[model samples]
Target chain A: MSSPFSSLHVVDLSGSIAGNYCSRLFLDFGAQVTLAEPENGASVRHVPPFDKDRRSLAFHHLNTGKRVVDLPKSKAELADLVAGADVAIVPQGFKDEIAKLAGDRCVCVEVSAFGADGPYAGWQANEMVHQALSGMMSNNGEPGREPLYGVGNRASYAGGVAAYITAMVGLFTREDDGQGQKASVDVAETAAAMCFPYVLQYFYNGTNRRRGDQDIPAGQVLCEGTWVCIWIYPHRFAAMCKALGLSQLIDDPRFAQVADRVKNWAEMFDIIQDHVRDEDAEDVVSRLQEAQVISACAYRPSELLENPHLAARQYWDGPDAQGLPRLGAPFRLSRMPRSRVNEVTE
Target chain B: MLPFENIRVVELTTAWAGPMAGRILAHFGADVTHIESPTRTNTWRTNKGAPSPVNYPDFDPGERRWDRVFLFNSQNVNKRSLAIDLKAEGGVETVRDLVLQSDVLICNFRPGMLRRLALDYESLSKHKPEIIVAEMPAFGLEGPHSSYAALGPTMEMAAGMSAAIAYHDGKPTVTGPSYLDPIGGFNAAAAIATALYHRRKTGLGQHIEVSQVEAAMQFIGPEILHAAVEGKDTKPDGNRVAHAAPHNAFPAQGEDEWVVIAAQTDAQWQALCAEMGQAELAGDPRFADVGSRKANEDALERIIADWTGAFDKHELAAKLQSAGVIAAPVNTPHDLAHSDYLRARGFYAEITHPVAGTHPHPGLPFHLERAPGDYRRSAPAFGADNAHLLGEVLGFDSERIDAMVRSRTIADAPNKEA
Candidate 1:
């Protein structure tokens, strides 16, 4: 039941989402992660949504399963501390200085808004800027309006995921050759990497796909008292027609082919909407499931809390420093034991 | 030499998420053998599941349409494909033999489907005690929704990600791209790598399960934490941070061109004002500090937009960045496809697939100076490695391989129905 990274030690000098989460994943793998915070605590600790007692939940979720230490005030002290570490995740701002401090045994992972040597590397950036810099905002949210970033800090989270993978790759390399190498991630590039073959499509054909509206009336619509999303492929559309007692609609010339359905999508949606207007949400869901249609009920956050599936899986971890329920491990390993230090961020 | 040169992976997966995980493992130098049923071809290879342009290299799928499918081809590089029918008489033994020789096994079948196939972790572990099984189920294995089927969009909704990502005043929506799929894939790859590391040390294998729903939650961790801690629900804030002023995508000259400018700190604000030739604005009471500027955000945006409207987004971003103010163009495919920055870093590799010809593909997200990943091999054709895998790796004689092929346990093409 020993964790994968049980033998490793880490010094984390990352501030915001990306570097911090990278180190946190290492912590989850049982690496002895030392969160090196400034004297006043990390910037996330001071961000909003504070409780009546002024504790930040962002910090509560991010700083679990790791011990905190005051970042060394001087270069020599920093060097002394990093000398014993197997990995050091440093922010772009302090990458150079930290790289010099990290010993040969330690791998230095630099996380940045752009990259280490890009022209935009020196510019200050947040999650939104990165979303824009990448093409994420272009294909997200409502079309024609100002581009919108997603609700959460997606760019930073993606950057963190990239950094963690890079670190693991580095560890894998080191395991063979006994050489811990340097790795880095550009937040913008990381976001772009997740983008569907958009760039490839653009390169192949002259098409710049724009952001479509989130609630495309045709794709997601209200069925009775519940929101349900439908991915209407030709096969699924036929099945949906059967489920809604509109079997004849499948043969209708206006909705027969994919192009015809696209042209008359509004009418087709209305017909489907009318049929489900009075049906129970659960009934609609069951009918669609039975018919093998590509459909899902739009669940809200509160509804997710009550989902019998999530409850049975026990996905939520304990109340951390701010007494907030945090998500447990992103993945589970049957034999590898998870962290038991639930009340961290001290 | 590649970092994962010694690693071997047996991929039993379908669609984007699972294939993407196998693709990454291949990129990292794992000897991945993709096992698909010839009778039940992966959905991505049939019909128009392939991505644009490359799917039809000369604007045609030619003779081997499945091999040319861009979606499957793009993610299946550097891997061998083995088409084995699990339902066939000798199919189970074919897979079991491959499993015995593999280091890691991966699958994304619905919760109980693998167990029904008698290839679940428990069943596989009994045969190969050192096998690392990475299971990526849509909802997860032991849940009420576990038995329910899903694509990325549905899983996103089930995970509450769609709700959180909606516009401030709009309904929750789905991304054009399945955003959570790649994230889940990346997590799966990382988990397998870590598990491999652990196995190397302890000589034991473990069952690793990565739920698409759970992995999606990591992106919205702060919001969930806030709601759980302070009973405060976080509303969507489109392109704007609470404390950062001038933090939005401002219009530029071209049709959809825009630039994001964020003056997070006082110096950045001063620099932005100076770059816009409105140094006097920095001294204005309404825009003096973070709090005041946030309060007067509308007015600030108007003034900033007026200046930004005259120049192209990329050009303006450069000017702002030179002055130490935060700025970047809201780039689309057009801009990204021809990016000088990406080119300078060698971010894109020109990979030549047999059917797709040559095209630019994204390199690894991170750079490893010493032992970088190798993208030498193109995606395998349907059951391309059947001869080599069965004859060489399994040490099977030609007669045995021929017999399996004759019985339809091995296939060179998808089933006639497919």
Candidate 2:
């Protein structure tokens, strides 16, 4: 099958992880993405999670399927490359420069920390800072304790996804008018969008929503030494009780409705904990799932590669130069399978 | 003109993921129609089949509770709603007719439900040979766990995100909101757009599948690769990055308030030290370089925390940012809703809905110079466009529409028992 982006070329001029990720999506769908690396290297190359040889695993994962070229030293040389490309992914600082170089024929997407024009524009922020400012960290961790910022570069990754979607929208607009346009993706705003429900909760209630407030039978519980995450809403309460061999609670007036469930959550959780205490994680999960309850064993990173479901789906992509298995395409297009090339051509 | 001005999308999705995909297209000018079953309404309308304070407006589930849900209204803006019983007679035919006019169809049903309803790609392609179908299953269509039911938290656990994002001493933890749902939504929208582009070029339609779990693993791809190469999992380190020291959230003056300070470069480190009134520490051997500071991060963090604890979080963040240091207050939802920066960027739009009243809604993350998207309309009331859709778009006469409504094939409200 022909790839969706087979005829397109993308030049990635943003030296951050977000830009690489945006271009990576293009390459995955079969566009010819060329990473225009600086004289030293893209900044992400120096970021960590390195292999034994001190090579950046993050950089490898983000750039495996793309071509790499040293950034041009002169404007004329850079213009030559931009003129041939269908899209350019650049940092916000270089938005105008790239737009001028590519003219009105190449779609340009600018990735930034707080957008090109905002009160916080040009402010310095890493992933953690982005999380803090975006309200993501504040929503995580225990309520009274210091908030936790999740691992990895989530804010920047979200920015990349937004950029990819925006770039496609730009391409569609260009198809109509025959003139490419510029778009901007702010990591902070993208991160904020992910916190939609919680933000709305505040708007609706006029209260700051905090973490660690699980309703009855809706939080993590221990089962045979493995923590299994379960989310049982009010309607599923009776079914969960019946499935977990606590049917006696199904008839208990104390656990009848939403308010009562919240008031007696601790007592109900203790009963659930005692019931699942000796059961194996898999057994407990299967039983709850059989009742149509949402549940899963919290898996470690290594265990996911060996997950029976993922294995059956053949979701892992490769054992590239470093002999490491990587994640496959985020989404599959039946008529356009993703490219699986594992080497970068300079 | 808007990017997707003439495009039409039919969405048969219940929860966050599918509705989100349709919402994105709708924002870009696609005329998206969200189809809900009268007997099995979107779960977001209620808290999984029961009224909950969190999902309602001002904690009130009004007379038409399903239409007044905050969760549903937040994502369903710019789209019309149609409540129909696909299991009822003439229902399948009605949807097939709508599919004939739609450029795209998106759903997040369990893998086989579409095929069971005769709405799967193979079935729909026969009617509208150029229809783009996108499905988001928790797992893939043919996997061992293909039929397994999953919510956002369970998918996060299966995707390895929970394990990668915990405190040093805590077990795997899910985020406050299920982060995986929106991620799945974004990926699915991107996939549909790509397929639409492909069809425009090659005159072909395709089925796109997004395994929500697999799509989520992309965010932590480097960690997965690390596990593969090193044969060991990277332990969860709370609020720290390998490339920087003093990259932790420190407590601020207010109770439970905190500020994040990330001194990634030497210049930033010097600025932080000067801001803390300890410029000499920047020259100390144990804090001079990134490696040294990392090795002594505990002591460095302690020193920084002592200084930060005396100031208000917002003020501290502003003070640090002014000194060329990377810093921000750990913001609560209230902080975000009232952010000057967000206000300046026009990130939130004041959208007024018929049932839920007017409120500020978040805008799209990206902005195009010429074709910037907007909230063209508020979320539809229950089946607000049912008559319009059937009468105009489907070309069904009022008599036939009334007959279908009498038979419960078409509904303007959810079944009371349901």
| Docking level of model 1 | medium
* lDDT, candidate 1, A1-346, per-residue tens: 5565787998888887788888888887788988888998798787554656787656666677678888889978888878868888988767656766675556788887777676665767777777776777787666666776665676788788888888888877777767787777877777777776667655444457676522232376676656777777766788888887889998999999988998899888888888777876656766776787766777666556555667788877665554556676788887776676666677
Q: Where does candidate 1 stray beyond 4 Å?
A: A47-54, A93-102, A205-207, A211-218, A223-226, A241-260, A271-287, B46-54, B230-232, B265-274, B277-307, B404-408, B415-417
TM-score of each: 0.91, 0.94
Best by lDDT: 2
lDDT of 2 by residue, A1-346 (tens): 5665888999999888888899999988889988898898778887678888888888988998687888999999899878867899998778788888988878899988887676687688887888888887887776776688887887788889999999999888878878888888888888888775666767766767666654425677788767787777778988888888888887789888778878888787777888788888878888888998888888777878787778778887666656777687899999889888866433
Candidate 2 chain B: worst-modelled 10 consecutive residues by lDDT: B47-56
lDDT of each: 0.77, 0.84
DockQ of 1: 0.55
Candidate 2, DockQ score (0 to 1) = 0.68
- What overall lDDT, based on C-alpha atoms, would model 2 receive against the true structure? 0.84
